[model samples]
Target: MSRVVWGACLLVASTAFVACADSGQTAAVARLASGEVAVSGTPEGIPAHAPARFEFGTEASATRVAMWDIDVRPDGEGLPPGSGSVAQGREVYNVYCVACHGPTGMEGPNDRLVDSEQWDDVPSTRTVGNYWPHATTLYDYIRKAMPQLTPGILSDDQVYAVIAYILWMNEIVPEDTVLDAETLPAVVMPARDKFVVDDRVGGTGPVR
Candidate 1:
């Protein structure tokens, strides 16, 4: 019995059938051995088989894994041990955050994060003060990604401080309030009730 195997060759797409001629046609063969089957010319090498194993990259190190796994949950599960006041947060915000977000959270070159209560009466842009439902999410987001130019550079206390400043500007917290793991999650945003629960039934169960 004879076995047929398609060679890894460039396939030609044509509608009409053309017979092999001496002009310029080359036939691709799966197996090529000395003094064996010859098409336009004699075979060059032996049969090529698929590779059994493939080697690409190395395993990730523990340090690298820890760096990427830095997400904080809504329940303040991953919060670090640190605290900051609104005053301290304002200083950090003026120094690092003001360049993009402007002097106050309302005066923004980017999205406004404060003075957004007017949105309740009129159709306005969604700022953190009016749209966000949780305070802990703010701390998590800023700590993971902020300072746009240089993210993940701020210390835990600095992250808490900057978050406090934003919250104070939004009127969600007192100016003298300090933000930490315990206090951050306890903050209830004004729009919390406005957001409806996700009750969509997925293929498996309820998405909620």
Candidate 2:
């Protein structure tokens, strides 16, 4: 049985190698736009290369590195210190967001940030309130890539405020709610229980 499995593995490996080589080869009748015959496959054998151990680029400063390391996790980890209220968010929305996202977050030329009362409407939209599992995701995404044209310009307070407004519009949070790193993660989204973690490895085994 072991020998059988080993033979099968070798056969599979050889077949895969052949497939890769075949894929690299161009069709026999293929021609370039300039009316020249195209090279079929890459030249055989690996070419001379640079030293693998050679290092490039200066060591980056911690402060400069921190700017790019702004991804907030699902658990609200990496949230910067800041707070914003629903009222403040509404004002921010009107000023900076209304152009692309429309009056409310729902009337959008872009993706709607507000939740729909009914999901069965003729023009259905997937919103952050009803679809997103984590509130931190909102804070993270908005802070990283909002305002459309000029991304990463909003302060932490503004990001929090806009998140608050969107959450309020969805009815996920009360209009008077204040959002910060501490409270943002605590506001469990409606779809939180719907998502399941997939840990599968091999098809016939238990979740890894």
Candidate 3:
């Protein structure tokens, strides 16, 4: 064959091969709009049967799962079916809270937020009896999230029991009383009316 004809034949074959290769590529594989290689079916390497959504799966199990994690709120929401007395609370306090909060509920290693003394110059002054506006905050902070190292470990009954004990020690409630949502909210902490509204904006200003 002539050299020119041979070169032309080779060029035609290469062009045809390139065209065939280009035709095989996917059209919507990687679109300009999405910037994703949109998968019409199951994505590469992912099994079709696998969950694309969250599921432990099935209706009965789903209800159980939801019920398992029901949240109890601060206003007597997740209060378990239990009751506690100041007597019981004293026992709980001795075991769980006393070392740091003290048996008398005074400030110990931790900030005593129950019945701590009032001093005009004393910094870090807050006790459950003297400072907390609502006793439910004590139950909520303790039960939902205390002990400094561990929180939310106490049962509802135990938390109420401890709170009752703290109140007794603080002198707001009698030693024989039981604490619950109804009674706790009504206890009327000494500082409840004493605390003035704070409306301040910056550094080293007068407190109202």
Models sorted by TM-score, best on top: 2, 1, 3
Clashing pairs in 2: none
Q: Considering lDDT, where higher is better, how would the candidates rank from best to worst?
A: 2, 1, 3
Give lDDT tens digits, candidate 1, residues 56-98.
6787887887677676655565678899989999889988899
CA lDDT of each candidate?
0.70, 0.75, 0.65
Backbone N/Cα/C clashes per model = 0, 0, 7
Runs of candidate 1 with Cα error greater than 4 angstroms are: 1-66, 116-123, 197-208
For residue 118, give model 3's deviation from the true position in Å.
5.6
**Candidate 2 lDDT, 39-156, residue by residue in tens:** 5544456355735434677888878877787887655667899899999999889988998888878778888788746443232556887778788998778888888899988999
TM-score for all predictions? 0.62, 0.65, 0.55
Backbone clashes (count) for model 1? 0
After superposing candidate 3 on the true structure, give the runs of residues whose Cα lies further than 4 Å from its correct spot.
1-80, 113-124, 201-208
Task: Score candidate 3 by TM-score against the native.
Answer: 0.55
